[model samples]
Target: MDDIKRKYVIPGDVITTGPYRAEENVNLVGDKIIATTVGISEIYDSGVRVIPLTGMYVPRIDDFIIGIVKSHTSLSWELDMRSCYPGILPAQDVFGRDFNPKVDELTSRLKKGDLVAARIANFDRSRDPLITIGDRDLGKIEEGELVKISPSKVPRLIGKRGSMIQTIENATKALITIGQNGYIVVSCEEPEGLLKALDAIRMIDEQAHVPNLTEKIQEMLGSNSE
Candidate 1:
């Protein structure tokens, strides 16, 4: 099967299957199984299926994320995540208690101008991503510098089950938090470590197809140190 036929079909591409039938395939990109003819047909072209370029953020449930706290009420906090709509993180969701604390107490816990790591709890028909901090691991970020990238680039940064993040952490001695919306938070004791972490992330964003990226990063760091 050709990559285009197997993965996705672009506009103006000719696909045929039915007896003496030819149809121009339109722009369709995804994991959807497209039928070329009434009966299943084999793909003629083979290549990597690439999604068309677009500027949009599609929110998913339970995605680990980072956002800045914009405003806070007695119950919830508003966050600015550079999306079509702002996200909301409620106090009960984060604190796990119904007892409303004083303004100062709440500030001490999670205040305005603070960066937090949370999870997507739900979304309304408007597609506004609602965040939560009910879990132990999902809560206020203790430390880190927030970095932003295109939401589409998250898959490349995460790699497989944190393999990429762990590799960078080990090499540069920096802690990293990757958000589904393409926000990165890096933390390290030394400025040099933070710089190394930033450089490694930029490299991954630029060259995602390269295998063994962790090893390549190590080599680059070693040469620079010398």
Candidate 2:
């Protein structure tokens, strides 16, 4: 954990000799806990966990995200989620309405260029990442301007209990939806509002690790408002 804390660690790096509660992105080899994936470890009194700094979005259970439909097969749709591999959005995972490839045109319901907001249903190493859009909040996005940022900065952009995002929303009066995989959508009637929200998101992504990030964003917004 010491080596992992100060510097970067690669896969198979021995994380701990003692019994450790293995957290995200790690594996166990013999009696030692090893890093299965590349990430940094944060050791707390209770346990040690990995925080990935760089890598594509590895879909985990229940991760809400936005994806662009790339192609669709007879059974499912392939989505580009900024990952090494595309995610699968099965017809069964669609909201109350289901499209049938046998009879109807799948592209009509969800075209190749359409943007969807969904959640990671399952992600097996052997299988393509599965996503579900059954929830009320999950569905097709008709209109919005999109932006991309580093996924690692998502938690910070959201802030404590969603304070950071709320600030940007209130200030800009734009409807903003964030995807854990780094895609963000902002919709507003006024073009100025959309630009402001995009600017705020840029600031958050670039300066998330800095101290008083929320305050800095607030001041920036204040001056811009003036």
Candidate 3:
């Protein structure tokens, strides 16, 4: 509940104690809340959770994610969510509510191997996560270079106050779309700038835990005379 400082921690490290609720990747032991993974720990309001350093992507409701269409049935399409469970996008989500499977051909919109920007509409342990791309910002991605990174490192890529991502964008003039599931799409007018931006992103993913990373990224971007 207090303003606990954030810190890097491994499994068994005590994040804090008190009446804080254990959120994720943390365990409640006696009066101490201990981490259950190697990651950064933080306390907010009355909850304590660990942002894991490495792990599979876990779909959470309302999470905006980029998914690859893997397959489809007559009723819905299955997407690779980069998790154990596939994302289900129902036919009605893409078509109107009056959609008829027999009349509305599924492949008329999206087919396998297509990339889509979607949001998790529903999820639980018992059922696969459901995703929807009906919103204004959600749909098939037609252009941009795809880049992947560890899902856990997404927050680090975003940085405090968007400093890290802003740096890369300003330096390279590249547009980057980040997915909570670790999928990224980058677009730039200049080919050289595109490569530079990707290199910077990869650097961040590999060395996120390294201190003074903001400064290091600045240096890397500035080193290019082009």
Best candidate according to lDDT = 3
Ranking by lDDT: 3, 2, 1
Taking the tens digit of each residue's C-alpha lDDT, what string does model 2 give over 11-105? 88887767767777777677677776666666566466776666777688899999999999877889999988798998766634555567765
lDDT of each: 0.68, 0.83, 0.93
* Clashing pairs for predicted structure model 2, backbone only: none
TM-score-superior candidate, 2 or 3: 3
TM per model? 0.71, 0.83, 0.90
Badly placed stretches (over 4 Å) of model 3 are 1-3, 14-20, 43-47
Candidate 1: clashing pairs of residues: 2-45, 2-46, 3-46, 3-47
Question: By TM-score, who's the top model here?
Answer: 3
State the TM-score for model 3: 0.90
RMSD of each: 6.9, 3.7, 2.3
Better of 1 and 2 by lDDT: 2
- Mind giving the per-residue lDDT tens digits that candidate 3 earns over 1-226? 3577689899999999799999999999998999999998988888899989898999999999999999999999999979989999998999979999889999999999999999999999999999999898899998899899999999889998898999999999999999999999999999999999999999999998899999999999999834
